[model samples]
Target chain A: MKSSIQRVKAIVFDTFGTVVDWRGSIIRDLSAWGECEGVKADWAALADKWRGRYEPEKDRVRTGEIAWTNLDELHAHALDQVLAELDLEALSVDHRRHINRVWHRLEGWPDAVEGLTRIKRRYVIGPLSNGNVALLVNMAKHAGLPWDNVFSCELFRHYKPHPETYLGVCRLMYLDPAEVMMCAAHNGDLAAARAAGLKTAFIPRPTEHGPGQKTDLEPTQDWDVVANDVIELAERVGA
Target chain B: MKSSIQRVKAIVFDTFGTVVDWRGSIIRDLSAWGECEGVKADWAALADKWRGRYEPEKDRVRTGEIAWTNLDELHAHALDQVLAELDLEALSVDHRRHINRVWHRLEGWPDAVEGLTRIKRRYVIGPLSNGNVALLVNMAKHAGLPWDNVFSCELFRHYKPHPETYLGVCRLMYLDPAEVMMCAAHNGDLAAARAAGLKTAFIPRPTEHGPGQKTDLEPTQDWDVVANDVIELAERVGA
Candidate 1:
């Protein structure tokens, strides 16, 4: 814990693994869909691989190696590549579009909704993610995650780890960076936010990358708050 | 009335005079403040002039005639000009800042909260105002207005009646222009939204400009929906 909690007026969260169980939700969703479609595939592995593609694909767009496109479009592009590699040729365009939206329909962790609802009663809570605004908005509606507002790197036309993404959110919220806390499961995200003068909270989602996840098992750097879950995080912050 | 109401999935409103009674609120607030400060000033005229400064100042920023500045900064600029003109040279900077935020403490019209709450149960309801996000957020929290989100022109770096403001909101919401409705009391705003291929809903706030307020007494154009107030608008749209 750090004394920075006294200055934090709003908490901007990292959504994918921090708030929602993306890997678990996607694996379960795709496994059910694949069974119904009579397709045999390792959906879990595919989910991990899809997550893996996120950085490289975004980097390509960010560095001007590729044209600018949104996260959904980027995810769809990667989905197509994975589908081809997995020999799932029978999947229709509509089906692929539906499947890509698995990112939109992620389920919150057991404590996520309740803790977030509590936090929202006191402070502004929103997603500061690489995911586009629509993706975050739709996910909030789907998961019943109550957000005061939604912020995305898409708003700045940049991705997380980029200082613009963190600062852009602060500018929109009319808060100095120090007054906004970035709550994430990943140290890399906390590091980026900390470097940008934002208060950082690390709540390790040990199973975010599924069982056998080795990285981000604990706080890699001194963060403002480190809690086991959003509920604990909320409790720690007096939400 | 447009036959196809289904095309409009979200209704983004204009705040201040369009949604809340800015002139009435400001006159009441400033008159009380003037009494407390023992200042003899025609507060009504000053309020009108202050509101009058909103458009041209934003236009200057929008067209690059002035550098991009948030509503707070713009309001501060106008406050200085109004203060000097009114010979209120004794007002301190802190008092000026407090007075400028009078916009954030507006009382909602009788039907505003209920009607907006109803609409929020169905459509995504937000204010796409020139007011920056924090102002709108605070106002919403203060007034208990049920906004699903806050979509300010500040996010788009342009002010209302600008195509970017309307189109940028639609783009950020991941909605087609046709899927979003511009709901306002002002015809000029609806005109811009219509020009941008978005639907329009006219809610007449006849007294928005107070006594002798001549403009926008009724809908000037054949908008998609015309209602007496937000309640009527919500009922007409099946909210």
Candidate 2:
């Protein structure tokens, strides 16, 4: 019998923390910008707090408490609150715009490009991210990611962990859920993928939230495949 | 003063005959297969008849006569009708499946990949075709087209030249219609894009409908940029 791994006709990834290091990239981007602009603040703290606000901010739209908002707006809104909280409010509009777009310029993990490139030869590959379509496209161009397509929550008007998102990518491809694989660093994401009748792969991004991060250090369950990083995931998938 | 061409942040394409030589490709593929299988038929006539059915079949979904059927279903349905009309029906299941997939395996016009690759360096590029997402993705992979992403009418559940389809792509990109350029060989497609407020590029594939093709030989309107081919498109776009 063919293995379930061989059944994955396409693979969709959770981009932030899984494929790109959002925390490190954002902190680095803001710190460099601050130094250039002669602005002083705890950039790392801002990154952390802004990311902390993300779940709550995203939840508002996810639960219909707020109107559908894309990631760019969510990030910009969260950035404002985090900046005010950190006493670094009153940024120039241009500076704020640059900082918010840092998400669009997030650097992919070391193995991301090579691994995805290899896997792409066999199965269709893309980012099923909460990022808006423009953000995903810009990120792909910036990171040199050769995604077959970009799946934005904006496309479905539904956030991840919502079954709509997990299955939406499959629906667009005219694929059965069983033929799709969801790859993510976060176990919760993989759990949702499995619950939605898709296969799963866990590739831990241990430093996703920076060196002190303790969560998502390893796969919490028996995902279809567990690999050290994207490179290993590519190898395990026999690409 | 910046020309409207300079305002284009992303470019979307009409794929079938614009980016790929669908008529020649389908004819060549079916003819070669027929030769190998010792089945004789007028492959060119079949190709033309099949393409002739495309617009009407697609218009069914566009006009809401049928529920949102994707391109794959529409193509398969049309192919069956063309096959019966040409007295070439009753092929084996696998043979029929292979014939149906010729669209996904289309070869790009001679300059398509190189030109699009150059253009992509300056702006995001994708196919804004009536083809479904899977079809676009597979075509890109097969043709070595380095698209930043794939756009399909299936995503919007509306077909061209519907206003919703044109605006939906801009909406997902968070861009004003004027910031997006629609590049196509068909004058009618360009007219639709122009009316929808997108900047337009016309690159003539003079033989897109084969040697007898007369339509879209020269752009009927003063398009934003009229190029010899995609190669000239890359140059005119200043990529």
Candidate 3:
């Protein structure tokens, strides 16, 4: 809600569907892998359901309803349940690991690399994601995403929406929260970042959940900046 | 001594003086800043002396000979002594901070960026420096060094050649020691890394200490790969 543009020095992103097209990328990747491995299932549905578990599972740990767990752990747990529900037979640990790494091979949105390159010329740009450090690192390498650093929930042992998740990045970068901006396609993410005293930029990812995506179809709250895409966001922020 | 290159998946560099010419960069930066600020001193000598303090000071913290200190604190300690020796009068905290950040604006060796980019295409290339995370991150940005992550001694709260420094990187990256190679211009650093079971590559910076530099002019110990420069190192490593 505030336009204190001069205060921001770094911008952290929500990675899953904002910087990268997780839904479409995962569907294509997993489908190809499934075809190669001769394993068949409704991977699109499974990918959506897997993402759906991300928040609730993370909330369980964050709210102390369950023990603290990393995104990798939560993903594994969700993967087990979904695989069982899909009537997939027992798989080896190696196979599970390979499948879990599908998250690491995500393709960036078309504008992601170019916009981030422009933004990097001006400010520090990195992902503040629920993903682990290794996952984010591999994804950056795979997708050619030019990140100044990879700030992950793995660093703080806490997931996003937790104030520590945002504040931990500021601490690591040695910057004040006010000097760091959180840009996400999710309103809840920006809301959390705003409440944590960090500036917020929202870019709607209407198709984040595919055609029937209902929530986060539009900006739900007033943010410091709202852009049509990463390119526009960079231009608007003078990056 | 071991030529077992099969296990090394990532190669992390020691940033200051190893990957980048810290002495040259700092001396030049500080000398220019001194001229601008109407201050005078033996900037080159001071830069060299400050670099010299790095190991002995870290050894003090690492071996419990002195209290544990982060790089920023150690840098401040060295700064105070160097300032007195240079006979600089009282300066404001802002001025001191600006001077301290000479470390963040280091220039990489001629082959640093191109070699690193090549290596990065084949391996997870990052900095495992004694520099604090923010300092390393900023240095990378300023120098256009392509690093997948900035793994600093600050993360482990222990400076090299501490085993924890090497082990912590592997732990964070989810890789075994054999899966990570420690690449450095200094033999002492490679010695410690090899002792800790990590693979080693030596790319000598004979002039790191400026004219008449003696030590680390040649690989004192057998390193897995000995290259004259980073580009040669990249080629030797099949990057």
Candidate 4:
């Protein structure tokens, strides 16, 4: 296999499940808020169900089923749908808005911050997520992820797994795709980036969807580098 | 005068002279490169002349006289014009491209890194410059500016001193204009930002255009905050 590691100058990440523990953070946040509001359901189930709506809503924008919308707005829309689905429509608008911002308050993986800090010293490191710019920026501040920059679907007006989002970052950085590495916890995200001529690194987040998660537990394809976590990924990159 | 300092949640900066020393850095880079290539000219004069074309070229884009183009392309166009004007056409194309990237390798002002690091503890900080996204991102990496996010004219598709660029950042951050402060070394940049309803801070860059720089050496308007440098600006902002 060709070692493209030496050629990589920038590493852009998929933020949600890669850098931040969105599933656990959201479940804890909503469960606490739900208890206070006297609303009860299988909170973990709701968390999983809520996340299940994420990509489909974004797909609405990607496929032009809806107008171009940001991830926060999409999350809000998806939240409403899930609330109605669970028969919990009594949640107030202000509460709903606050809950929608849970994505911004996500806790980073234990190694995310220090690993990113180390790798940042050697390469330009930043989020290349489907999240909006404000969401990613706020999360970086909240989680202490020292990103050199923030790239978002809002910047490209295209959702990830789409070629535009992947290629647009390279265009913005004035770099060839091979010189940029797309690092993610999801095998699918890495596969898409690799197909787009970019270098790829996969780090499995087996519990990203909770302990029973069946997919993305291992690199499904031959990725450029597969590490245990960001810390190991940083070591692999010689940072 | 109203004290809007307490209301500010984010601070966006005008980068060129405010944060990075473009003139000195470019002059030093090109002078060393020129010596190596056996090229000869008054490089300082060329640097000043090249900077003189900066706004007018962006103005062409702003006015639709030229199609929307990135700062790198505009810089290249300006460099070609200056090279022709100075009769220094013997420089190779590769070397000229390297010279154009000098903007990316600019050194930060003496107080820029520490002051920004201090202020960032209390606020969201980033460049709101007319430079493209990659340029600002590269400069932050080059100078250790510790920006929480990177904003650019390329994101808004509008140049600074334009309402769109100022208002665009507020839109991305989901912030009211009053809650975001525009900080710059240039009063005109502050003036433009203020007219758009944002708070403004001016920190004079006396030697931005070299020691004898005559303009923007002091605040000409009743800016919301006036400080000697970013360190003082951070103090005024309660960081």
Candidate 5:
């Protein structure tokens, strides 16, 4: 472990792909729902396309093209567009509403709960994701993630890669930047946290974007700690 | 149970006296420390004096006499005045700092943990206290309070009786005011919550201020529900 890990008092995680398997969970959940409803459509391609829209939505908020919209609203609006693109307009408004909430029902990766419970024993653990407060709170309850608190971009009114999201967690928790570790699966997220002066830990989820995923399969820079999954990340950090 | 109880999807609590016995905890902890350090002082009197300073400190912030200061800072500032008044200047700065965190180390009431856990299984449960985020988080860890999330005056930048503090919890959780119930031992807090459009539950802690406690001995208004303790409150609300 890096010497900086010894100073860490809290660990904030990226939720979407790091703590929870958004891609696989959404694909599996929506596919099962569609089959049960007799609403045939290409669930996998729709899932990927919908996930692709998340960045653009965040960019609009970051660049000031749009006001601070919570992730739940962004996800709902994006789901509407993708449903139309996939010619699934036959799904009712209520159906679309429930479908968009698949993000809230996303399941944790196999090691997520065990790892978080362990790290939580030693440090303040929470989700510092771009997801809104309600979405992250619901997700934690659904997935049994033992977060000490849930920190969301909605609370800071700034998305990931923004300095406020990284620093806000430290400010609210009364810890210095170096005393808070930003643990995530995405290289971009960790790079931003590093730039914001927080310790960084990389946990690569190679199948996060599905087996064909080509990016973020390894640590792109010298993060303070790098592990194959959250469980190993906990052990490596001496949690 | 009243029909309003059925509408409550979330329950937020007051921390100091409602869930935890601050008076008892601080008096015992500080007296033990005083004995170990070969110091002599009225621990009970000091505890009462420090708590009495809390309202004036909050009044200063709420009236714009000072900027938005968090509870930890307010507590530290109050401790300075009380220490001088009681002539306890022999303690080191480091000792004072650790001593001020007794608020974070407060133990929950006998039924607090079990009651909160029961309510949590049925509805979202959290602390919507004037305490700062770090204080409440540390207190929960110390007392084993299983909150789904923690809300604080620091998050809203407003203290209790301010409509913002009462309604902020609902807004953050994406619920209507009626969907959230404010549970407290203090009648003033529940009155403010009711005025702010939230459902209210009163669980009078008659012994919170020690056996001589007089105020808030009974429900002052027709609150949505009233009970003797949190365990009864949980049952009254049909949790």
Candidate 6:
């Protein structure tokens, strides 16, 4: 265990659901904006729909069906689709932009800041998310995530589940893949990271997709570390 | 002046000789290590010689004469030349590598951390150095520079004074060039940044090249802000 802990010198995190409560944060941001504008809608449903657009849009880029676009652009494009489908076209262009910027202001999970802070004391901690650089940097500042660095798929021009995004952090940090651990709530992300020679730690964000969340509520495979939250992750990693 | 300040939303720094006293740091590191290793040489002259090798190496990369190599690799190669010239061949491979890691342990200039902290309250502050990401990240951790992000030339595969590097930060931050300011102790770096349409702040590090420093003693051009040090830069920027 001591040898295992020593092998991992840096930990790269998956940002959206792993570190930040994206669904909760975005719902709150939209609901607040709607209240200010006197615009009414099922914000929870809208939030779910907006998030539901995320992966399919990224998949377009991943499959080379479209030119490389940053997360901000992808989010904006998806926002248009959601707005049209929800009939929230009452929102002005400025309002739509303000809504799109919600991703920049995500709040961390209850355990995120403390867990990352504790682990940061022992290892280099950073976000290796599919989010773009601007999105990740602004979110880090907004959420107080205490990242030692930012490694976004925008820097690599590839999204997560791609080998480039998983291995790019190692290249940038000049560390071997095994020296960097990938910590995420999603097993698919961990599987991809593991496939790329990175160590894997799984922490179940059981409420990530709300109470009805059916998938990724627990580790599906024997990962390097399985914890209830980031604090437990730190302990298991000997941080 | 207020308009200029309001226009700038971020400030990118030149790390070596700007936020950190690289000459002083390198000289002290080499002198201490020499004493411990029972090696004797003119460490000051060695420091100067080592720094003198810096730009020429990046020039090789910039001119496409060599493949893209990070600052750490470049520094190691240059260290070998300096060791050979100074007859310090008694140093083992590990000893040489340790000496090259001096760049990662540089101390911030006396006013750097506080001034950076002050400015960071309003604007995004980060290093826009030719140093690689690993080097800049390690130095920030070592010296407590409050950078919101790290921007190294290694990210763009081009060295500064290249237009891509200065403008790359603007693209990453999703800001217009005019909205970003380049703060540096070196006039040359500021000049390149200014040429790339970035706002320029010149802070003189008169002793950067030791007591005989003959250049960058003051602003040589009509830069946007000319301050004595980073503290004054914070003041001028209204932080």
| lDDT score, candidate 2 | 0.89
Q: Of 1 and 6, which scores higher on lDDT?
A: 6
Model 3 chain A worst lDDT run, 10 consecutive residues: A1-10
- List residue ranges in candidate 2 displaced over 4 A: B92-94
Which 10 residues in a row give candidate 6 chain A its minimum summed lDDT? A1-10
For residues B135-232, write the lDDT of model 1, one tens digit per residue. Answer: 88878767777776788877888888889999998888878999999999899999999999999999888788887779999888889999988988
Q: What is the lDDT of residue A101 in candidate 1?
A: 91
lDDT of 3 by residue, B49-116 (tens): 78778777788787898776778778888887877776774876888888888888999999999999
Q: How do all the candidates rank in terms of lDDT, highest first? A: 5, 6, 4, 2, 3, 1
TM-score for candidate 4, residues paired by index:
0.97
Can you write out model 5's per-residue Cα lDDT over A114-223, one digit (the tens) per residue? Answer: 99999888888899999988899999989999998988888899998999999999888889999999999999999999999999999988898987899998898999
Clashing residue pairs in candidate 5 are none
Misplaced by over 4 Å in model 6 are: none
Count clashing residue pairs in model 4: 0
lDDT over C-alpha atoms for residue A219 of model 4: 88
Off by over 4 Å in 5: none
lDDT of 1: 0.87
Q: Please write out the lDDT profile of model 3 over residues A34-148, one tens digit for every residue.
A: 8998878798988888887887788888889887677777888888887777777486687778878899899999999999999999999899999988889999999999998
Q: Report per-candidate DockQ.
A: 0.56, 0.82, 0.73, 0.89, 0.73, 0.73
Worst 10 residues of 4 chain B by lDDT: B1-10
The ten-residue window of minimal lDDT in model 5 chain A covers: A1-10
lDDT string, candidate 1, A69-100, tens digits: 88998999999888887788678888898899
Q: Is candidate 2 or candidate 4 better by DockQ?
A: 4
Q: Give the per-residue lDDT of model 2 (tens digit) for B37-61.
A: 9878898898889889989998897
What fraction of the reference interface contacts is present in each model, in order? 0.45, 0.92, 0.63, 0.92, 0.53, 0.55
Best by DockQ: 4
